[model samples]
Target: MNNDTVIVTGSKLTIDEVAQVAINGAKVGIAPEAQQKLTESREFVYELVNSNVPVYGFNTGVGANKDRKVEADYYNQFNVNMVRSHCVAVGPEASQAEVRAMIVIRLNTLLLGYTGMSPAIAYMYRDLLNHNITPVVPERGSIGEADIACLSHIALTMIGEGDAYYHGEKMPAKEALAKAGLEPIMLGPKDGLALVSSNALAAGQGALVLYELKKLIQLADMVYSFSLEAFKGNVSPLNEEINRVRRFRGQNESAAHVRKLLQDSYLWIPHIANALQDPLCFRCACHIHGAVRDSLHYLEELMDIQMNSSDDNPCVLINQNAIMSCGNFEVVNWTVAFEMLGIALSHLSRAACFRTIKLSSEHFTGLPRFLTPDPEHIIAFGTIQKPFTALDAEIRHLANPVSMDFYAVAGDIEDHCSNTPYVVQKTRKIVDNLYYILGIEAIHAAQACDLRQEKEFKLGIAGRVVHQKIREVIPFLAEDRNLTVDIANAYQLLKSGVLLHALNS
Candidate 1:
């Protein structure tokens, strides 16, 4: 467990902080003011409940059944039934980290006082996270208008009616809560809807994906730098003045980082190139990577809003002393941004696959074909391209837009859908696949660098560190034994952040 604690103030939680709590097991603390707001919001909800004003999902029923009335006497059971019914989400279950992310995100939004949920429910979220009692949540069955179908599993655990993980051990939610010295929450008016009706599932998972991507973009730059050195590629394209002429943020950022990584390398030596122009994969690497960064920036901006703002339907207005039905749950804006990101990552995947292919060709690198240690006897990287390209192909397929593909659900009242969860889920798959693709690319680049005998061919600061790190786990492809083991090791090296740590050190 991380000793660090993330203080949630309802409106200021960051993606990095989310990573800390979700992935690192950091304890969570709610802001005092936010807790007070929860009290006020709960009071307002009771006031409305007594008045019999028939607010949607409050005193009245929800969805197509909105015309149905919910008397105050049945508030507890109605809410419980709502939660149990929404647990229609199917397996495979979400990871413990993902469930933690969902809890924290939902907890933050509840503090905004827009959901009118009981303060006890909010505290339950804090307690669940603090105790490491992660609810077993299914990863599917959400149309993304809201993650009600999926998130209900979390509410199930809150009421001590489902399975949960307590300190990394899976057991009944009741047992987990008891072991953690906590009690099951009693659902009140609107409590069940409050617990499940939000986009937290998608938002939480998406925030993690963004965190990984931030590092991935930097890693992509680092690997590309090493590949440039191995290719003896022209540094003209990376020249600061040339990249700055266009004034694109992502391109300039990628180009500048690559330049920094390639600092003091022989690539900077004027007239060191084998040709005036390298392949587009080598020349436009930064631009392609830049496009990914640019797309990521857009998604992050939208995700920030999604995380902090109220995504509740029938949002409570404490100032106005009223509850208003609204569509704050709609997440199409960020859903499409995720779609665009998938496309951007597809381009990144293709570029990496192309770069790896170029690295193996004798025509491009002037090294023996397939980066063979002994071309006469060893058939090295020739067949290895198939795996990385297959992974890239999967990335290309995952990049296809699916946000707009949905039928009218919920008795046609919820006619539209963003499929936000699936969009974010697919983007995550794209990032994971890139790790393999880039790992293979790194393997090829390191091999090309080792095979280069030119007196002028030398690694820069980042290259030396990356090469050393790769060789530490994955040796030079000395007469190709099982490349599958090598590929797996390279993936682990990149995924483990070993190379990034070395570069930073």
Candidate 2:
């Protein structure tokens, strides 16, 4: 992640490495071993292309035209036509960051050297990233078996067709390539197929999500701990003994996090007057949050493998001395894993929302209704709960699984679809909604903590850190003028990692 260049190799690439190159703008190169294999593979494909043999996408037509043969003279135009004709994607443009990540993933798969693409072809991708020329990829039109429609746009960029963003200016690919001091690439033999056939667009977004989700998971834990403290809830529910007996690693980890956050708190001391037990939202925090943590472990494992694997088809096998077609393009397993993440996040968001509602209700926390300073005169946090409820509903709706929700395409040859892009995009939306929910919880929790402070109650270590940080940006709800400003500031604080840093520090 430092400024040093990342080396792509036959060895598996980690999500961390991709983050370094894509997010940090670090240069990327092909390892010597990968380069050697790339050259050999390209030579082998050229030999087959020259012969009268019919290979899918190499010497003959593609898809339903497999029986039809393409003349060697027309191969170049065939490649160009393949890229241009497939540029039918329609929707909002993906962020340049996502487009960059897609190119990086696609280039890494090519360096695996099984797709019969030359080192020259791979360098074209490297230059695209290094020079900051991003192919303008659309957000829709992919059923996700392979990112044909999306990646075909990228293929168009390579050949100086379609649109690209260069130096922050949207322009024609020919202009962008010239602006970057690069030339248009001519795809040869199987290079066009290799470029167009990939799951890079989806996989790229997944890698970024994994990186962002890590920080959010820890932030969710910190905010929930603050909620428990604000409500003066019993800490017995997070007892290590109970979690240890269950033997669920994620549950135990969640319990430990809560226990650590509650260190030096008054909640642990014996008190007879407190409620005998808290509501399910506070009591089952460990189990629900732990499931989320557990799912993340599984997701990270899948993402790491995905980041390293060759998600391609009709890959050349040099050792077997044959070009074999395959089904490595099926990424439904990863799509399902993302759905599990979405579901887990939905549960966590609902719990956070419930805790917020309970904290503001006199019947639940015995605090002033809506956490208002003066329940008799001042109207504060009254209408604030509407947005939290709305956010929770949105999160829940997006959590519905779409991994099994697509029809066949390409005349049934590419029959199945993974819907990975839609899955990832929905998961990203859930993450967005959860942040506002956390902000609302923080707003209510800070008020409850402030009210308890009036009664000589002490906050836990985690509670103190969150309260202090929120106080820095937003004062307590002394009298409500506009709560939206406060909520926005609190959300920014959460995203800024101020709360998480307390535990780490």
What lDDT score is found at residue 386 in candidate 2?
Answer: 95
Clashes by residue pair, model 1: none
Question: Could you give candidate 2's per-residue lDDT for residues 12-74 as a string of tens digits?
Answer: 777877877777777787888888878998888888777776788888777777777888888
Candidate 1: tens digits of C-alpha lDDT, residues 284-378: 99999999999999999999998898999889998898899999999999999999989999999999999999999999889999999998999
Best by lDDT: 1
Best by TM-score: 1
430, model 1: CA deviation in Å? 0.7
**Model 1 ranges off by over 4 Å:** none
Shift of residue 243 alpha carbon in model 1, Å: 1.1
Provide the lDDT at 273 for model 2: 23
TM-score of 1: 0.99
